[model samples]
Target: MSTLEPVEITAGSLHLRPWRPGDADAVFAVCQDPEIQRWTTIPSPYHRDDATGFVDGRSPANWATGTAAQFAVVDATSGELLASVGLQDLRDPAGHPGVAPGGDGEVGYWCAATARGRGVVTSAVEVLCRWGFGPLELARIRWIALTGNEASRRVAVKAGFAIDPAPRSLPHPRDGVIANFWTGVLLP
Candidate 1:
């Protein structure tokens, strides 16, 4: 496993950084939103343990292994967690951990209910993409959302993804039997 030197990003009014143990409470609370649970693959009945494990264990492990780079988007001033974003499902063309340039990955995010409608997500997404393209040197990043998830679709579009002319219906590996999602891609 490769170890990455994690970095923080500052967008217009948002700051993104690797998850920290101190963030468990906020993650636990934001993740309880029904919309978050409905749209993202986060467990339906999210528990405190889940949040603790995510912030304290999984997030860092993924980064250390070069498997995924996850961030907690927070208020620039208050340092409050506002959302979760990540370059996930990372892998090279041959399906190995994508720590080097030219690998492909998926961009995913979920916002806190209080943070919605403020353009926070779009701004964060754009900045994250810039960093992904720069330091990570990712060749391409894809965005996928389940059908009827207009909110996510809008964020994807605003972040510069050229969605397929006719959206495709395909199985989303994370959802196990996941199907019928819209797909879009951004190339660097």
Candidate 2:
């Protein structure tokens, strides 16, 4: 394992930080939004316990294992969490399959209902990708958005992710098939 501990990431209007126990309420509030449950992998009808586990267990557990990095997106001024962002499928950015033992890193993010349409998520994602590409030595950063997810697609494009077709059956966190996917590479 890299033994690189998770740390806070800051963008202009957003900060990506490790989730704290006190974050449960804010997180739960965000999760409760209908749009969140409708679009993202978060369980429909997400209960308080889900938020608890996300804060107290999931994020910290990933750090301990060095397998994932999850950040709570917060307002830069107030330090209030507005959403979550994650870098998953840990591996180098060099596109080397064998030399890099881990899988390709995938960036995932969501914005709070209140924060939607305000450019917060896009700004956060761009900064996060830049940080990941440089220090993490990433070969390619893939952004996958389900078809018709215009918001996600727009963010990827704004962040310099080129749109291209990816295989269907992309194994969405939700139960059904995702007919289309968009993938973009961060060129060296």
| Per-candidate TM-score against the hidden true structure | 0.94, 0.86
The lDDT leader among the candidates is 1
In order of listing, the candidates' clash counts read 0, 3
Q: How do the residues 1-188 of candidate 2 rate in per-residue lDDT, one tens digit apiece? A: 54347789877777888889999888888888887786677878999999999889987887776556788899989987777888766664354321133235778888888888888888888877876776666666777766777888888888888778653557676776545555665543
Q: Which residue runs of candidate 1 sit more than 4 Å off their true CA positions?
A: 172-175
TM-score of 1: 0.94
Error of 1 at 12 (Å): 2.7
Candidate 1, RMSD to the unseen true structure: 1.4
Q: With candidate 1 superimposed using the best TM-score fit, by how many Å does residue 108's alpha carbon deviate from the native? A: 0.5
Q: Model 1, clash count?
A: 0
- lDDT by residue for model 1 over 123-167, one digit each (tens)? 888888888889888888989898889999999999999987676
